[model samples]
Target chain A: MFEEADPDLLPEGLSDRLPPLAAEALRVTRAMNDVLAGHGFDPVQPPMVEFERSLASRMAGTKRNRMVRFVDPASLRTLALRSDMTVQVGRIAATSLKDAARPLRLSYAGQVLFLKGNGLEPERERLQVGAEIIGNDTVAAASESVSLAIEALKAAGARDISVDFTLPDLVDTLAASSLPLPEAAVPAVRRELDAKDAGSLVAAGGEAYLPLLYATGPFATAIEKLAALDAGDAVASRIEGLKEIAAHIDGAARLTLDPTERHGFEYQSWFGFTIYASGVRGALGRGGTYRITSEGGHDEVATGFSLYPDPLIARGAGSAKIERLFLPLGHDRDAALRLRTIGWQTVAALDASDDARALGCTHVLDGKEPRAL
Target chain B: MFEEADPDLLPEGLSDRLPPLAAEALRVTRAMNDVLAGHGFDPVQPPMVEFERSLASRMAGTKRNRMVRFVDPASLRTLALRSDMTVQVGRIAATSLKDAARPLRLSYAGQVLFLKGNGLEPERERLQVGAEIIGNDTVAAASESVSLAIEALKAAGARDISVDFTLPDLVDTLAASSLPLPEAAVPAVRRELDAKDAGSLVAAGGEAYLPLLYATGPFATAIEKLAALDAGDAVASRIEGLKEIAAHIDGAARLTLDPTERHGFEYQSWFGFTIYASGVRGALGRGGTYRITSEGGHDEVATGFSLYPDPLIARGAGSAKIERLFLPLGHDRDAALRLRTIGWQTVAALDASDDARALGCTHVLDGKEPRAL
Candidate 1:
């Protein structure tokens, strides 16, 4: 049994949204879905709680241990609140959507909980809006997902947005190289190489790996540099795919390639990218591909991104255009009914004049005197 | 530490929606917001987790013991995932939105978690879409919220819908009457009345309470009967308010009044209502008025409702229409890009003819033929 507290103290890290701001956030999330749906992405809402073993067992490394877990009294089974939507999406795609068509494009918007320290310093419940494309393994499908993400972000009012592209193959190439590097020396190699540390790269993987690490830069230049390197077949194949993606995007110059940049769950495969805006310190959204092995011997490729909307709003993105109309006090109920019937957004107030300004009314009607239309 | 699995098992209850259905749910939830927003309701989104203390303490009866509780790692405090949106809305109204203008009308669509048993027996996680109005306590505001809910449901494509209204004061009226009843006997009395068990009502509350209990019928007729009931001041005031609401709705023929309809959290005051549709035994949505008394002597009133959209969708209420365009193998990439730029939802396929029908595509363009558009 737990001791109850006095009512004054609210649970920490949770706060309520008031009228205008709350209204705006909801509007933005809806608009995001509208854009996504228009592009053929469908919505899927999963249950918030799931079997703890199913969620945490497969998750690699330290992240899984942070999930909030409890026992369901009725089932007497351990259940965990969903820590992320992608994993849930993966589960659904593998199970319920098994016999469905390949290249399934699903989108979702919901609140996902994570144990503190996964991302944000003081973990807060985040309102995440995201989309996932499963079973599509082609470069064209991947590029389209990226394009749609940019368009959706723009539709959600994100301005000056840019996408930073990173290839997982670049990291894989470095790891697979015949460098007699000790395990402890890997982090330093990754960091220094990411920072373009030539000396550190020479010290770790030797002068042979320098050109490949140094080739990382803006998309086009990096592609050309990687082509020029004496890289093996795997590295060369990755470069070709990256070039194809760069060629397909309308403004390929805006895309940056960072060979050493690695972010995302360890499960990510090829073609990872992040969306960045001015005020947002972290990526506004992030995603990559992961392979799911089905019941039989089939493997499905899935990729998607989730947007952290609170920071976007805090950065002055996604403010709703509120159109308010005020009806005068003592207005005829029948007339108000008529207005409602015609689909007008209205507020009927006793003190119409005061309420109009407070509600930010764009249009106000006088009840005292009926005017001609 | 946790045992590792093969990652084949999908977390229970969570789902991934395929095209058309996922698209349709998005459309329904969006349409709901459109209708609510048109009725002067602003949208709001609250955190998915709250302090277990804030949520449980305010819940007056059995509900306090049923919330899903877990320790939040960030705050190192016990937190409960929100079992319902109403309590979070109340906390916001009492604190954050306290200074906002009176009669704060807000709307929301999100996932809410309930402990295994409270009401929804087998299913615990639910997608709740609802609206809340805080501050001013008026029959008109309550009626507006109820009407908006009905309109929203209808817009979500619910063909058969019914709204059931009940007065909370009637329970107080029966309790205060000299109808000899023990504390535990009250729920049974209320249940019998709700089920219209006239014999049970008479046996429990006696002949004096029969008039009020049996006064359940069509909204208008029930209101008329309540007006004539020889009840105390509390019951009479509540009855008068119901009459006023019935008069305003005009289409009182569609409304049903069950004086014994006892549903809602303990904090609800005044009128309570639930929306029901075909194929769903439980109410598709439920909400009512709530008055909060804080430790600092602050008092606030809020009324709202939440819709369980998953069940509504399960009953085949809201689904989306989807059209897919498939581009054939060896198709001109430039042409596909042009089509996509012009707003066509296109998926480029290698060997398109083989997968076109399986992709649920209505139209397919062969890359070999330039004449085919």
Candidate 2:
């Protein structure tokens, strides 16, 4: 009887959305998709489940354990749920649509479940809004993705969204040095470098790799610092790539080159960036380039970004302005039909009209009377 | 070593979306939201996980056990991953937004995960697009939800969409009878009733319930059949309510009434409907009215529909007509900038242009040639 009375009890780390926040997030996601679509990024959806082997590939990285896994009763194969859309795009580009095209531009919005211990404050499931650019390996491709990310943020009503650009190769070079580093020491090394701690990195390694480890800052300063590094050639090339991207973006002033911003999935290669709005502690959106080996026998380069809509809603970012139409308490069906035909989205009660007004609805009508709520 | 390689593998029943289906589904979801928003349905996103007790109380008698369950380490309280968004909406309405006004018109689009053994052939994780109309129980509210569902289907390029309408009270009357219904014999009973097997139902339930069980046809014919049922005045009043809803829909001619179409979660009450379109054998969308009782002394009545986007994409529905902008292999940064400034979404490769063309893009610019692809 207890079970019969309550069958829908949800497990931990999940939730249902209701009015105001859920509605606001939907509006933000839609507006972001619009800007992305307007910029010619086509949207796509992949099944949430895939072969566990496919999901466990190196390309998926530590994200593998976070997935919830189960055996398919019908096929008896180990099927795992997808944690991210980019890797799924990799699979689709490799197998499903492999013959049709190259350099596919795809966008997606869906929920991604991660295993506990990722350090999410609430450890909640994420409704990720993201876009992936598969099949292109050019500075322009990277730049276009960054531009679109900026535009999407702006469309979501972000006032001061700034882009922090970083080169993964810079950190990779430092990690490759002879430092006798334990596996767990890597995160510490990354943290120190991200903090621009030249002193600590030199203490851990020798003075030989100090210049490379210390080469980090806002975009302009990082570029100058990279030129002064001992591994100047590799660092110089990455800086040049960043410079090329900056030249193409109209608001280059908003670009910050933070050589120390090192936290990301290991798959990230070449140029990576994080987007932030004023007052938001974490990035509102993020993306970078990566390489994936294709079924057709070559590694394809790609870049993508996923926007966290919850934070934007927390900041009151993306609600749409609408007019309200209110029907009286007992308005007849004919009257409601007449009002709908006139393009008024009628609320069927005076109380609902008051709620609509609170949600920033500009116009209100009670039956045929156009009155301000 | 294995753990170090891939850490973020998704949990069971979740997925990543890829193009052109991902792109197509996003467009369709956006259009549906727009139609709902135009009708004053604000968007909302509930948490992906919630307390098990909260969800279970709301999901009584449904197939909700398919939801993956877990214990939150912080609280040591049982929690469940959300299988659907409706109950979460109820939670929010009851708790956080309790003071907010009534008649909350809300819409949402997100991925929902269902556990195995629910009898859905394809994977249980799905991109669910839906809206909920809360607080009001008027025929107009019901009509508006139906109209929005129809418009959303039309916008999604459904050429031959059909709505199958049913009433819960009518089905309850058949279930309440003391007929000797065997557990193994019930599916056959349902199938026959779904087929409008008046003779079979009469033989199975005997003459006492035959009149009520046999009522089925197009909307008008079913109304007459329902009138002849041997049920009492209360059941007759419920039938009258269903007829009123049937009459208010604009395209009422397209509705088919099936008293036996009782497939849904147990939360459903009053009217129910399923939408079918070409190339889709199963329901493209399903919705009905439900009454929820909250622990906080809040009782709310609501109804809405959820459209499954994966099947629509699999059936090649909701393809957007996008214009393509192609840059030559080595187009200069200035040229790319100019194209973007002029509102053309420029891609860096010729292949990307081909994908755009396949998606109904006519304008393609490759180097000096700006012509239709």
Give the lowest summed-lDDT range of ten residues in model 2 chain A.
A2-11
lDDT of 2 at B109: 69
Tens digits of lDDT, candidate 1, B220-278? 78877876776667777777767666666666226788776675635567778888876
Identify the leading candidate in terms of TM-score.
1
Tens digits of lDDT, candidate 2, A75-156: 4566665676667666666665666555677777666666554555454467677777777756767887887788788777
Model 2 residue A64 lDDT score: 64
lDDT of 1 by residue, A234-348 (tens): 7677777777766767773278777656756356677787887665677778766667654345567777777777766655433546556677665676666676666667776
The two-chain DockQ for each candidate, comma-separated, is 0.49, 0.36
Q: Scored by CA lDDT, what does every candidate get? A: 0.67, 0.65
State the DockQ, from 0 to 1, for candidate 1.
Answer: 0.49
Locate the minimum summed-lDDT window of 10 residues in model 2 chain B.
Answer: B2-11
Q: Number of clashes in every candidate structure?
A: 1, 56
